[model samples]
Target: MRHADVAQIVHTIAVETNTPEETVARMYADTLDSYRADARIHDYLLLFAERKVRATLRGGNSNRH
Candidate 1:
């Protein structure tokens, strides 16, 4: 997916989860950073990062300020 698409996904997820967009964006960036060494394709990388962001929101793993 494209960067704009990912941003939209993050925005949607943030709204749905009632979390701040900045926080979610930071988490998404962090997720991407953590997965930087992985050999997976770009699509999979975005999928995994988004999944991590979603899980973090759903599981209350984020600071949520």
Candidate 2:
């Protein structure tokens, strides 16, 4: 995994859990297995989803078909 992904995960979990960095980090490292494996796997989904979103947005710039 990329450092970017880990950083994003850390920041996002901080916002979501509304906890201190230490607690959120500990939870992420220790209790992620409390979630399904797909929870971790789906972290990669943002890459494709962002690409699709950008493509859609770019397509919108064309007023003509």
Candidate 3:
């Protein structure tokens, strides 16, 4: 994903969850890295990372898809 796309996702998630942008950005970067490690297809990495971060901030399990 582009840097601007990543930034937009971070901003959206932070606003939606009422979390700090710094916190969301960190979460996004960590989640993206984790996905990158095992990913064969790069198409949805950002989307999956965004969802995972959102789920995490909302008190959901990070282990789920």
Candidate 4:
């Protein structure tokens, strides 16, 4: 995802989860980085990272969605 897209995701998630934007962005970045490290394809990295971040913020696991 582009920086702007990721920023928007972070903002939206923060608002939706009542979490701080900084926290969401941090988690998103970390999740994306982790995924990128082992990913063979880049197409779905952003989507996966976003889902993981959301799940984590919701007190769930990355396996949620």
Candidate 5:
């Protein structure tokens, strides 16, 4: 995925999980750098996974539809 997309995911997770975006992203980046293609973080990249992201990021400002 593009770094921007990954960034969005990180931001989504941070907002939902109440963690710092930088910290969450760094954890993924560092893990990806370590595991390369073996990164488990990819699970969050799937279509359904985006639901969690969207649900978290979804405020009254935007609609998923």
Candidate 6:
């Protein structure tokens, strides 16, 4: 997916989960970076990042890491 699509997904997740967009963006960037070295398909990168972010936010562990 494109960067804009990923940004929109992150923004939506932030709003839906009541988290700050900036925080979500940072976490998303981190998540993306973590998988950057992997050999997985690039198209699914955002999906993986989104799931990690959503889980982290939902679990209320965002502040810890």
Global lDDT of model 5: 0.57
For model 2, what is the C-alpha lDDT against the true structure?
0.48
lDDT of 6: 0.81
Give the residue spans of candidate 1 off by over 4 A.
Answer: 60-65
Query: In candidate 2, which residue pairs clash?
Result: none
Give Cα-based local distance difference scores for all models: 0.79, 0.48, 0.91, 0.88, 0.57, 0.81
Q: How many residue pairs clash in each candidate?
A: 0, 0, 0, 0, 0, 0
Residue-wise C-alpha lDDT for candidate 5, range 3-64, written one tens digit per residue: 78887877877887787887766665654454445555655434334443445344432223
Off by over 4 Å in 2: 32-65
Write down the lDDT that model 4 would get: 0.88
Query: How does residue 18 of candidate 1 score in lDDT?
Result: 97
| TM-scores of all predicted structures | 0.76, 0.40, 0.89, 0.90, 0.52, 0.77
**Model 2's TM-score against the true structure:** 0.40
Top TM-score prediction, candidate number: 4
Between candidates 5 and 6, the TM-score winner: 6
| Root-mean-square deviation of candidate 3 | 1.1
* Native-to-model Cα distance after best TM-score fit, residue 16 in candidate 2, in Å: 2.4
- Report the lDDT tens digits of candidate 1 across residue range 1-65: 67899789889889988999999899888887777666555647777777778878888553321
- Encode model 4's per-residue lDDT on 6-39: one tens digit a residue: 8899999999999999999999888889998988
Residue 3 lDDT, candidate 4, scale 0-100 = 82
The TM-score ranking, best first, is: 4, 3, 6, 1, 5, 2
RMSD of 5: 8.5
Better of 3 and 5 by TM-score: 3
lDDT of 3 at 9: 88
Question: Candidate 4 — which residues are off by over 4 angstroms?
Answer: none
lDDT of 3 by residue, 1-65 (tens): 67998899899999999999999999999888999999899898888898999999999987766
Task: Write the residue-wise lDDT of candidate 6 on 1-65 in tens digits.
Answer: 77898789889989988999999999999888887777367877667778889889888553322
How far out, in Å, is residue 11 in model 3? 0.5
